[model samples]
Target chain A: MSTEIDKSKVVLYSYWRSSCSWRVRIALAYKKIKYEYHAIHLLKDGGQQKTDEYAHINPMKAIPALIIDGHIIGQSLAIMEYLEEYRPENPLLPKDLYARAIVRQMMQIIGSDIQPLQNLKVLQTVAEFTGQEEKKAEWAKRWIANGFNGLEKLLEKHSGQFCYGDQVSFADLCLPAQVYNANRFNVDMSHYPLIQKINKHLATIPEFIEALPSNQPDAEVQC
Target chain B: MSTEIDKSKVVLYSYWRSSCSWRVRIALAYKKIKYEYHAIHLLKDGGQQKTDEYAHINPMKAIPALIIDGHIIGQSLAIMEYLEEYRPENPLLPKDLYARAIVRQMMQIIGSDIQPLQNLKVLQTVAEFTGQEEKKAEWAKRWIANGFNGLEKLLEKHSGQFCYGDQVSFADLCLPAQVYNANRFNVDMSHYPLIQKINKHLATIPEFIEALPSNQPDAEVQC
Candidate 1:
């Protein structure tokens, strides 16, 4: 089933700390896909993502656009889906249709419902609107809590050792990055016992652990 | 390949003006899948979506949750994907994996990147942040324009009469609703020629026309 596309050209444009970027990294790791990594410092140089050179790669000015199978796929979900289709082994989706939909629903609880509102750009906008720097964290925490509240409820029906059943699905890829972001915003995880339980277990998985922001080449060494 | 679930149980919880709801509407119409439409007025009674009953249907508390095949699928993209997998006839996704990925990338440009940031709750939050009722449209327009700018670029490479080639993929389902929302916000579409062209073509589609917000059972019938 190999195509004419060269495998060596696969590259991932990513930022060390971006949640969306982390999701793709975990997907790549979990699938054991190989790729070259190019760090796009989202906060450095007025966002390297906003530059003309980067715009040629992704007009959305977003990170984690993967160049694979001779195509540039933007959006983490799109990229992950492409990978799932490109290499079907160690599938990120479940075998059953209902389970797959539930996994996607859990993923969107973070992807659509939560992450967009609390991203770096939106937080910066909130700060500008209120003229108060502290409002940034407050704003991020509110949306995180709001989405986690729904996510925990869904987890009650769907979660086992992971966000779905015992298998680590696409939803689990989203969990660690979001929980990391929530901790930064001082979101109390005690309210989301199911999420806390699953995230705790995910921390021990090599696929999740290897994709941690701290493990990335561009990660800033903390003081 | 028929399922045991009753087709009569297929239901869609939707709001007339909701962009995400409209996306699923178009998908269902395109596929000719029959379902019961239950309107959840997002603005009435402090949002019918906030009720505990609605939470059971979708803990994310969003509209366009489809109850089909004896399963409740939340998130427009998730539901749409479920639909694509559930009924392979008149598929919303392309057969080619690269084409499927491209369609998804175009869809996410609206789904993940644009729509979430400009939805009802986020707009209300924006108004509360600035204490100016006018900032709501301004905020919505900004994100819509930002996303459309990228989308138009992608369309240049992918579009023919529709968003990707002449065939209507899932990306086309997202177009009319977003264009309708953009028009409401007064986003100058002159900058996005490709989007404007594709949107114009999509209007002639029966599936799209039938799913227009104004065509729904609960439409407010604006003066």
Candidate 2:
């Protein structure tokens, strides 16, 4: 089932501020895969994703696309899971079926629940269509709180130092990227100590640090 | 890993019009898993999910909850995958890894991309907080089309009789449930012949037919 892929041959179409992109960046770093980054400015010129060049690559007009051996994979969770399956050395999911289900469930809380509500297009459309900038923040805050609360409760039962036991699974990669966006939008997090503690621990990991928005070349211009 | 349980023991907390519930229903019927239908009207009493009992069953206050062995699992995709894993006699995923990934990506297009944009909560919040029903529909239409277009392209490469090479996989369960909702909102399907062909094929399948909103006990009162 394995194909020999040159480590340097892989390329990621990413945006530094895109939380979806951050998920893949962390997964690649954790898997210790060497790849080149092709930064796509999601906000530029009504989104570079809509351009003829990028449309040929991804019709969905979304960031965080992975190009491996001339095959393009979209969807952050799918891409991350693909990497885990191909590069099983440093596993992102546990070997046990129940444990894998738990980890995948936690990832779903972020992927399906939190991130979609607060995606850049959704928020931008919220403002454009309604002219309610404050309510946009309110929308993001409400859903983030809703998702994080459920996650906090789930983690309380299983937390050692991360979202699922002690391992830095895909859940760990997803949570910090989402929480970081939530913080930037002024979503309060003082109540969940476990979430705060896990984020603190995640901050210390070099893979996470390297994938931070601040570490990307495009971060300065956007900020 | 197989556990025997009484046919009458299965319980589903579902809403008649919910696309999520429809997905689970199809999965359960496809696997021949008999279950009791427990209708929790999403709109009644400002949503029955907010009630103490329902909330206890699903902390997320979402629909399509599967109660098996007295344990609850929410989120339609998660519940469907769990059923597929537990009841492998009728597999919903392909035996090969690449085929499985393709099925998963198709499911992701619905679960993560299309359905999230048009979710009840998202539309309700947009209407209540932003007073932009028209714009919300536009947003929904855009994402749905985006997802379907990518799916259509993928199907070009992958389809034989379904979204992933003939056999009924999780994608079959997902696409019809989503496209049904999209069409209810007048999302034109004229362009996506592949999707249309598949959905037409799926509608005749007894499992999907049984799960239709019109067939549910609570459909008349709710819709």
Candidate 3:
């Protein structure tokens, strides 16, 4: 069933290097939803997210906000689930409720567990508290290791060709961006073969490749 | 339709003072699902969550794990969503997709934004880094204030009687538990009248009232 909402008018407020933004971008691509990418430099002039224009789009002053037919949706996980609901032709979730729960669990591991610990503000706090740049990196590495260890164990039980199974759900969309961030911080994925394997497979997907931070035009100029 | 699964056979591995566990407790009460609560002392014996048995239940070594028909589900948000799926009669999400997205966003704000910052590990890290109890509390207060400010703004727009209008969603299950933790740390809620109001409303509810940390069987007994 086609949604009554107009498809051509959809726009995504995103930052090139934000993993959360990349999750939504991958979801849009997977669902074949055509959307205009409106880049918002998160670090420019004390962050464009705090600006009036962006705040009007998302009161929370966060990235990965979706504007569909004038209605705004914030939060990357929420946006991906919304896309799955509106555009069900190319489904992102599994048919069974149990399977869907497993997929959502995977999303939560990244969305809730990993991403928040390494967020910009948390990094800043780590720097302030420790008064050492190396200590901040260590803090980031610690949380990443903790989250990835749990993820690796969970993936051991359920992973097939992807994080959930053979099909690519929202979990697949999350893994690449997180793996990319981890790589930047020099996280040792060699201990997590399943994660490394999934990352390798996701890298070959056109949707994942196109959504890479380096692929964005604004990423070239580095704000 | 009554699920074939027996509610009485359910067992919840929880910690009385843990906000995450309290979230699951509220969900169980809301659904009227019968279950035995097995308390895990988060602080005692150097965190009982790291014990062999608890690790078997949840490799993540987190509290608020639900064991149903021999299968285990971890993460408070995921557990509540799973409950809503199986016990759809007491729905925690709205019928409309947009409405559901709003509910999920509220959950995200608590699950991702607020809860993690003040969690045990983060708090301990702050104390370790600062080498002062007062400074750690200050760190806690700062993040909580930032999160609550954003939450209050979002609540102003969406709240009616609860976090997302009249009917309680998964968001309600999360907010009270989190707010309770913030209150324990003496983070004043005077600024967020909407949150304070909702906190009062939630407190009066039988399910929420019964799920309080003070009301737990393990409350008086030191871990």
Candidate 4:
């Protein structure tokens, strides 16, 4: 039975080095899904993300909003989970409920607990609280170090080849992205040996390699 | 054929007025799952959650860690999603792909974007940046107001009786919890007509009412 093809392609509104967008890109590549990449520069021209045009796409005005069939979905975790539910192939989460919970737990540790504290917008607002212009990279490193300390301890037992076990899961997807940001902030990776180790291994995977910030169409030579 | 009753009991390590904990409570009540509640005070004796015992339970040392059959799961989003997957009944998330993505999106908006910025630990760390012990509730109100402004616009189109629609999903589970915190922070809910309306309505529901922080065993009479 020939079914209707989805002509409305998946368009990812992403910033080149965005950890969230990198996670989604890895998920898409792992699922072997095709997508059109739209680079929405996060820092150029007072952040293209803050423009009225992007706000119409995501009122949150965040990058990594996945547009499919004209329906836009924001939030990286949501976008990745949507792909899992929509395709259910090349599963990013484990089959067992308990195991999947652990994967989700690890992802949330980074996603909810860690990354939000280090977000671009959140960092941009840090000067208001500091009563002076704070170093953006310093703010990022502070939060990343704090969160990664907790994450490193959590990964002690659960981590095998990846965050959970032998197979790559959602935790693996989230780790690389956060690690990318960690490197950018000059966070001491030595403090998180396991995280650094797992991140090192994930870099070798084809999916992770393809989704690297340097591999993106919007990749820029950083000074 | 009669199904065997599961012998393993569910135990939740939670704190009263913890928005993340409240979210998991609502999901458990909505699922009608019998569970033991262990109150892990977030702000007592230098924060009980920072204790060694709680650290053993959840390495991340966060609240709302579900212990079932000797296995533990931390993070409210993970716990709620675990409930959805473990039982797959009384679904808090819609089964349809697009619908579920939006629910998760709204949940992430509240879970990742809003609440983390206002978390007890995050607020406690504000002194590091500000050089003075800041007003905790004031800080909470600031981030809540910023996030709600964006959320209000998103709800303008999607909201019906709930954040998504008439049917209560994970978005519904998340909204009430964050709204509960919003009240504590004295965030002006009047600015968010749709959010205020939905929150008021959610109060009438048994699940939400039962999950109220005031109804919990550890609830203290606020002076």
lDDT of 2 by residue, B1-223 (tens): 0134233378898988898899889898888988889898888889887766665566677787777755566678778767877788788988866677678777888888888878888888778776656766776777788788888878887887888888999989988777877786677898899999999998888888898888898897543
Cα RMSDs of all predictions?
4.0, 4.5, 4.7, 5.1
Model 3 / residue B146 / CA error / Å: 1.5
The TM-score obtained by chain A of candidate 3 when compared with the true chain A: 0.92
- For model 2, how does the per-residue alpha-carbon lDDT over A7-119 read when each residue is reduced to its tens digit? 34688889888999999999999889878888888877878777766755565768877877556677888788788877898888877555666677778878898898889
For model 1, name the residue pairs that clash.
none
lDDT of 1 at A157: 94
lDDT of each: 0.88, 0.80, 0.81, 0.84
Q: Residue A177's C-alpha lDDT in candidate 3?
A: 77
Q: Which candidate wins on DockQ? A: 1
Residue B13 miss distance in model 2 (angstroms): 2.0
For lDDT, the strongest prediction is 1
Query: What does the lDDT come to for candidate 4?
Result: 0.84
The list of candidate 1 runs beyond 4 A from truth reads A1-8, B1-8
* Residue B116 local lDDT, model 1: 88
> Residue B79 error for model 3, in Å?
1.0
| Model 2 ranges with Cα > 4 A deviation | A1-8, A221-223, B1-9, B132-136, B221-223
**Predicted model with the maximum TM-score:** 1
Of the candidates numbered 2 and 4, which has the greater DockQ value? 4
lDDT per residue (tens digit) for residues A1-223 in model 1: 1223334598888988999999999999988978888899988789889987788788899987998877888999988888898888999999999999999988887888899899988888888777889888888998999999999999999888888988889999999889988999999989999998999999998988889998888989731
